[model samples]
Each structure stands twice: as structure tokens, then as C-alpha cells.
Target: MRYSYQIVVPAATYAPWLRDNEFLTLFKQVKKNSLVNFYQAYELWSLVEQLEKVNGDVLEVGVWRGSSSIVMGSKLKQLCSEKHVYACDTFEGVVKSDASRDNFYKGGEHRDTSQAFVAQLVEAAGLTNVTLLKGVFPEETGHCIESRQFSLCHIDVDTYISARQVMDWVWQRLSAGGVIIFNDFGFPMTQGITALVNEYRRDSDKMVIHNLNGNGILVKVKV
Candidate 1:
């Protein structure tokens, strides 16, 4: 028997706002100064748009050079000024990558940043609603925000170990209708992360996973 599958593209995928000049301006601004490319930065802006509908705090794991964090903070300030964006990153780099699964990265791969540098970027952007946590997740930074609930969580750590750890930490704490965005989900280099996300989707009943470009969107269903 032949199996069939269909691709699902949301209506909002081509929303005019994503192509508007304002978004383009912000996208370029972040790309020019931050470490992420246009596609990744654009995805971050699109994900942040989900925050206008949800309620709770925001979190970003594996922030590199503060590009995505800045995008999130800027959007939150414009839409929900009361909410704070917690930017967590080792700034030291990608932790140890699973040698057998991850092909493109190694221990401390993207470690060309520091907490102070990101903090300065945030401050310079006039974003006061940001908290920068510098350290390994679920270890140093995770405990600090363990008691809080999140409406939006962005996980870009390019490893299975870190991705799984952050997922465990955030899934239960995610508010109803909250959105969790996973970066590099469709990339070949981080197949380990792809496996982790796939396993999670298989085991999860309350969560729905959608793929968009190089990202995975997980939205909590209302009970």
C-alpha cells in the first residue's frame, strides 16, 4: 500500500505584516547586529507575534548575541509592556554535542559571546523588560525561573540534551494556549534535536507540533 502525507501551511504564513517594511526594518536591524541570519531572525519576529494573544512571561533559551532576544523584547514592549522576556544563554557556546548524532557542532561551538555584551545590546535597544541569565540551563538559570509560568518559550540550543532539558522544564509550566518555538528543527546539522522533538511529539497528547521553515511550533491546547 502507498502512504500519503499532506503539508499544512497556516493562513498567517503569508500575512502582509511579515512582508511589510516595518518588519523588514526590524529584521535587517537585528541581522546586521546580531548573530542570526535573516531567516532565523524573521522566524523569531513571527513567533513573537504570538505573544499578543497569549498571557504570561516570555523565555528564550540559548540566546546567541541577543538577536532573537532583542526581537522578542522589542515586540513585547510594543504589545505587552508588562511582561518580561527572560534571555538565557551560556554565552559560552553550544554545550557538548552528541558526537554520534550531531554532525555540524561540537562542545562550545558558538561561544563567541558574553552576558555583558548581550546586556549592553538590550540596554542600548532601550529594552528595560529583559532579564539576562548567563549560564547552563536547568542548572544555573532554570532554577531561578522554575516557579514562573511562561506564555512563550523559544529554545534554540542545538543539542538533544539541552533541548530535552528545556522542554521538560517548560512544558508543564507553559500556560494554556502558550507557544513554544524550536529553532533548527528542520536543519540537517542538528538531527539530534530533530529526534528529540519528534520523540516528544509522539509522546505528547496535549501539545501539537507544527513545522515552519527551520522552526517547530508547539502550541498547548486548551483543556
Candidate 2:
């Protein structure tokens, strides 16, 4: 039997962006504001486009500089879809980071960002479909969008607890076939996220996809 979850480092060289000028242009524009690398950003872009017909809004729990959020928003705009991207962040840094379940994060990490900074980045991208929610998320600002259904939820919170909370909060609201992508998965520095994603590998209703680009994608397979 195949392993439920494992790492995949592709030996083949495949770069689709070289032939797709549009994605490359987008990567160049958002490179400065995002910590997400090109492979992850490409996946985000492609996934948003793939789910363009899925009925629901989008959610991003960790809006470090709004780069990945912008990627999704831009893709939505290109498709001329009306889906809105709800971007949440503490703007104060990482919270709910427990050292027992986490590595490399204590608290107050990624605090170099502010709501205003992300706002400007969003504006410069000309994304009118993005909304910024400044807080710790789900507990602090999740109620603002309590009634919203999400087609895509991006969890970059890093810590095991923080990532777990965000995942728990979004799971119910996530529509069937919706996806949750963990940003720091597969990285040694973010063993917490890796652990959290691994714990869900046994779930029946979800399909866990391990991306070589350090992303963990969970797709809801059951309605």
C-alpha cells in the first residue's frame, strides 16, 4: 500500500511559467510583498482559477505582506469572478504558538507588517475584491465573516496550534471540494505545520496532497 502522506521531489524539470507570460508577469509584481516562493504562488494561482466556478469566498489566515492573497485575487479578477478574498492577520505577529508542538516560532514573529502596508499592496494590485481583517483570526475576527462559505482557505500561521485553530474554524465553512493549503509544510523550521497536516492524513472526507513546493493541500472530497 502507498503511504498516506510523503514528500515528492520531482526529478524532471518542468516550468510552465516560461510559456505563460501572464503568470510570470504576476510573479514579478508580487515578489516583493510575499514570502511565498514561485512554485507555491503558481499553485495558488492555478487552484484559484480551477475553483473559479466553486461557489464561495476565499480565506487567507496569514497575510504577511499580502503576496499570496494578491495572487488569488488577481486570478479571480482575470476570470472575472465575483468571489471575494477575505485576508486575515494579527498584524502583531504569530499567536497561539506553543513550543511543545512548534519549532522556530515563539511569538511576535512576522510582525514587520501592518494593515496599512498590505492595503497599499492590495491597492497597487488593483484588487477591489479583497478585504483585510486585522486580528488573530477565527477567534478575533472570524465572526465578521461568520456566515460566509469558503472555497479556498490558505493557512500560513506556522505553529501547530495556530494552524490547527484556523483549520478547525474553516473546515465547516469550507464548501465541498474546497481546499486548504498550508504554506510552511515540509520545511524543517516549521515542523509544527508538518505535524498538523500529517495528523489529518487519515481523514476520510479529505484528500491530502503533498506538494514538493512545501505546500500541503487538503481538498474536501465529501459533501
Candidate 3:
């Protein structure tokens, strides 16, 4: 799997100047209700904007209240118009967590959402290229996008089990020059995420890891 593919990590690119104002405006509209801070929000928005380096779709594994989805989908509309963004989640919080590693979260913790609610947010953002797949990760909804390829996959599911499963599901299908952003990696409350990325690093030698805000980025170095 490692030698069969290659990943082109573009020299850190910048978002279009015009999109800066758009990002700030869109981010502020949802920041107060979002789980991520400004720095992290900007990082996600900027990274998605940089996906112009690759030609493929995008995926956000966890969509809490649809804030990140709104941020990414809005930018993707202008940046990667042909690449649809897939927002996959249970829409009922997380599934069973690894109690041994995951101390703060349990199953059903962030269950304050529904597909209808997220759909409303996407619609309100005027983003027509976003698809919200509601279900358990990989197992339940993975097949929904079975044969699709992705340029970027954001794994923010907040669990060791879910993150590992998402990584397994996403790695092969991710395109050359693609990136996998792991949210909450360095976060104290979500040490499980950190552990999960470390495990991947130990097993895979072809990935280039980057740290930004509280996220862990894995850029595939070989296809």
C-alpha cells in the first residue's frame, strides 16, 4: 500500500486573499457555537483551500453541530468546485469509546444533533456540494462512498476506536498529495487521539506528519 502510491506535500501554500475575508465572515457566523477556536478553525479552512493541489473529494468524519462542515463546505464550493465534501457521522454523538484510553468521552456524549439540523446549516450556508451521511463511522456509512477517492479526510470523531477505523478506511482511497487531518491529537481531554496517531506513525513509514493548532496532519509521501 505504501509503495503503490505517492503523496505530494505542496510547499505550504496560502489561501487566496479574497477568501480570507470570506473565511473570517463565515467563521464568525459559526465560531460562537463551534467546538474549535479561531486558530483551529482557520487552519481547517486554510487547509481545505489548499486542496487545489490535488483532484479528489473531501471527507469530514465528525460533524458536531455542523460548524466545521459549514466552514469546509463553503470554502470547497469556491476552491474545489468539482470535489464534493462528505460529512460522515452518527449525528447522535459517538459510538462506544475505548474506556481505557478515552477518559472524558463516552458513547452518546455529543448527541445533540440530527441530520435535519445539519442539513439546515448546510442549506443556510448556500453550499450545494456537501453530503451529510448520518450513521456509525466506517461500518455503517463507509459503504456509502465505497468507490470514491479523497484529497483530504478530516478525522475528528474524538475516539481511539473511531479514529483508527477511519484511518484504515481512508488511507487507501486518499489520493496522491492528499492529507489526513486528525483533530484533537494534542488535546489533553482527547489523549486517545494522540495515541492513535502515534500508532499509525509507528506502523507507516511513508507519511509526513505535521502539527498545527491541536491537530495532527498525515501527508502521504508515497502512493
TM-score of each: 0.86, 0.94, 0.87
Which candidate gets the maximum lDDT versus the true structure?
2
lDDT of 2 by residue, 29-131 (tens): 8897778989999999999988876778999999989999999999999999989999999999999889787768899989999999999999988999999
Evaluated at residue 75, the lDDT of candidate 2 is 90
RMSD of 2: 3.1
Candidate 3 C-alpha lDDT tens digits along 1-223: 1112234355777645446788778887997658876767787788887887886888999897888888888887876478788999898898759889886788887888889998988898899988999899899999999899999988888888899889889889988789898887777778888877877776553464746567788887677
Of 1 and 2, the candidate ahead on lDDT is 2
lDDT value, candidate 3, whole model: 0.81
Name the TM-score of candidate 2.
Answer: 0.94
Best by TM-score: 2
TM-score of decoy 1: 0.86
Q: Any runs in candidate 1 off by more than 4 Å, and if so which? A: 1-19, 33-35
lDDT scores in order: 0.78, 0.89, 0.81
Model 3 spans > 4 angstroms off: 1-19, 208-212
Over the stretch 1-223, how does candidate 1's per-residue lDDT look in tens digits? 0122345466765555555686677766667656555666666676677666777789999888888898888877777568889989988999857877676788887888888988888998889998999889978888888888888888889988888889888888888888888886767677787777676666544565646566777777852
